[model samples]
Target: MANQEKKRGIGFYLLVGVGALFVISIISRDKNTSPTTSTSAASAARPSSAPEPPKAPQIDARVTARELFEAYEKNEIAADNRFKDKLLEVSGKVDNVGKDLLDTPYVALSTGGKFDILGVQAFFDDASLPKLANLSKGQDVTVACRCDGKFGNVMLKECTLK
Candidate 1:
């Protein structure tokens, strides 16, 4: 009967639709998880030859941690104009040394108050973990880094002992 034929056609189309969706999902999953795909993408983005050694960033200024923190606390805009993104040699008495919420190592340098909550925060790379482990609170230290402006604390990034 024509009615039976129509039902069969609808069922067939539904089954085909489901099969097509399943195939598409598998293909998309493969594209997402394929190691070769990621490897090829990484290769395309990298240089073909040997990479050169990284050069040290030039020092733009030198100041104590208190001086740096006070500068930002006084006038954020003026301080940023003078030190933001510029490499600096900052020396201060260490207040703390620990990893941040994201596991980034940092050293907090005192900015002068006996019960101060904020200080200059200097972030170091993972390679500096051993060096950071050797630091103690109240010890004098100097670091070279780029000033990343203030966010509660004056942030210094890519820091290394100087």
Candidate 2:
């Protein structure tokens, strides 16, 4: 009968559930596993003579924001010293100084009344640069950036105000 078959199916499921729970309970018992003293002693006696791994080079280890920007604006700080690859933290102003004659969004950084155009076409895109929509003229802030070093060429990326 349908009722009998339904009961049987329910019972089957209950049995399976109980079995699974029992198996899990058995597996959950902690095993007092530990390295043997002999093994540890052997390791200590031999010891790893290999040199320790080199520490990760911190970003500041190379250059800071001011240094990176100055290098680009100067361009005489060695050609092999490409800085467009590092993330630099900078302190400046947040602004959208209007587009150029060709209609590109322009951003300026004000530092002690000496403002420099971010120098590259990049610091304008909505994705890379900060929205700066809430900012007023001359509001000071810090930003993280990567520099593209070309003569009189400096752009900021990941521009964020802190």
Candidate 3:
């Protein structure tokens, strides 16, 4: 009789454990299915309207070629992270206004030495080639550019004379 009671108790515990697991699995399955169905219904209702295009990021700061060089000299990684991908309006003496290795037009802003080696390099859009062609060494120019961060020198892309 005692043995039969012990066996019945073990069977009851096993059944309870299985029942708890089944309930938990069903609850979890329902939770997982609900979100997917709601998302599908929401998309089906909004199929015609397209999402808006993202706006261009605003300019973070402006500085001259000398100031920009000084910032990088002080802390290269910090300056790169702070100014990378930000729009800028930089004004300085023209160092070089010519073609790059890829034949793309560029305007180098002087940080006070050699034209090509020690300066901020600003690459122009194809439309600005004619305007860039007119720029000469030693002339002052202010250009709006998207900063590409410092390599050997500070680099700017999509530059336009301002």
Candidate 4:
């Protein structure tokens, strides 16, 4: 009968639809589980704007923070030749411990004068936050950092407590 034929046709299409779905799911599963595909997908999911962690350079010099500041104040060009872009270990009393305008943590070390406004400014990375949190004014400390020359103050970057 035509009615029986129509039912069989509908049932056949239903079965075919299910088979097509099963095939698609298997193909998708294989693609998702592939090593290359998964690795690339994971990398793609990471934010492009995320910055890499800062790396500390090898120490190239060691001096007191006051000595470092005086060197730059006396002659910037000579100081730059001696210390610019080089890692230095500077020791001094903490003038202040606070964040810069950009919210970067910094420790201002005294340059041997009570009312001196200029000194060595050591900027630390996020990883040094815990150590910096324990620091206080007038506390003697030593920092290892890259000498970035002077900009109002003798600047030290990528600093870590020593």
Candidate 5:
């Protein structure tokens, strides 16, 4: 009789624990769903427009190609956190002015001497190609561009002549 009572007590506690866990799961599930439901309802009630482009960050730091490259070479994560997605004004000697695989115009600036492999690769849109066409190798140039962080080189986008 005592063994039977003990077994019942253990089974009851196990069932209670499982029930409590089920109740907690349901409560957590409700909590997660409520925010998403409210957000969807809010979005549905609002009028939509064209998505805006990312604006250039207004920072006073005049970062050069060599400096930006060296920073990334030293510590990529720190350099990315500092320079990524920010507007930068870079001045360096032009290494190449050419089109990419998509025929998108680009300007590459040397990070070191002409023999150096690392460069700042700035991509330009179609409208900016005419301006990019005139740039020659070994020319000193200044450009304002949005830093997109480093790959093999310091990548920049939406560049404009400065």
Candidate 6:
């Protein structure tokens, strides 16, 4: 019994350490990426830039997941309506992940109870999926996406593991 308890304790600490390292790596990557992107007057800054770019999206992901959902709820008259249609960029956790027939990956984030994600789907292009493909279910993350409506649809354009 004592040996088993000790093993469990060690396992818990090891997991925590690994999680911390992962977080540090993500923060550094985000920082290193931002300067390179903003300084270079690339496509995102251009007026005719596409709706959302993987490296840089139209909306900022720093805002908490709850804030975006609450904002949309406030703006829309009916919560049951197309609440997912808002052009929001927010962050949350990867509640589930799946692979399509084409071998592309899709991830779903929990709205933290602010919104319902019944049949909605969030997309992550090729660039951002790698950092998160191997992640576990409960991993916290921030995603840049355009919500389709409260009907529970969102298009994920970017992701940063927090």
- RMSD (Å) per prediction: 8.4, 9.8, 14.1, 12.5, 12.6, 19.4
Estimate, for each residue in 1-162, the C-alpha lDDT of model 5 and write its tens digit: 999999999999999999999999999999877768678899999998889999856754587889988899999999989989888899998999988888988899988864778778998889987787788988999988889988787899888887
**Model 2 Cα lDDT, one tens digit per residue, 1-162:** 999999999999999999999987776653345568898899999958988899843453234344555655566466226655565555655444555566555455553324665433225445423455655666665555555445354565444444
Evaluated at residue 50, the lDDT of candidate 3 is: 70
Clashes of 2: 0
* lDDT agreement with native, every candidate: 0.95, 0.55, 0.86, 0.91, 0.87, 0.59
Q: How high is the lDDT of residue 60 in model 5? A: 46
Model 1, range 1-162, lDDT digits (tens) per residue?
999999999999999999999999999999888789678999999879987889977899999999999999899999999999999999999999999999999999999889889889999999999988999999999999989999999999989997
TM-score of each: 0.66, 0.41, 0.61, 0.66, 0.62, 0.41
For candidate 1, report its TM-score. 0.66
lDDT of 4 by residue, 44-160 (tens): 998678687897566898999888988998899999999999989999999899999999999999999878888899999888899999998889999989899999999999888
Better of 1 and 3 by TM-score: 1
The 10-residue segment of model 5 with minimum total lDDT is 55-64
Displacement of residue 32 (Cα, Å) in model 2 is 45
Q: What is the lDDT of residue 62 in candidate 4?
A: 91
* Residue 145, model 6: Cα distance from true site in angstroms: 3.4
User: What ordering of candidates by lDDT runs from best to worst?
Assistant: 1, 4, 5, 3, 6, 2
Q: Residue 44 CA error for candidate 6 (Å)?
A: 31
Q: Each model's number of backbone clashes?
A: 0, 0, 0, 0, 0, 11
Question: Model 4 residue 75 lDDT?
Answer: 97
Where does model 3 exceed 4 Å of error? 1-57, 114-116
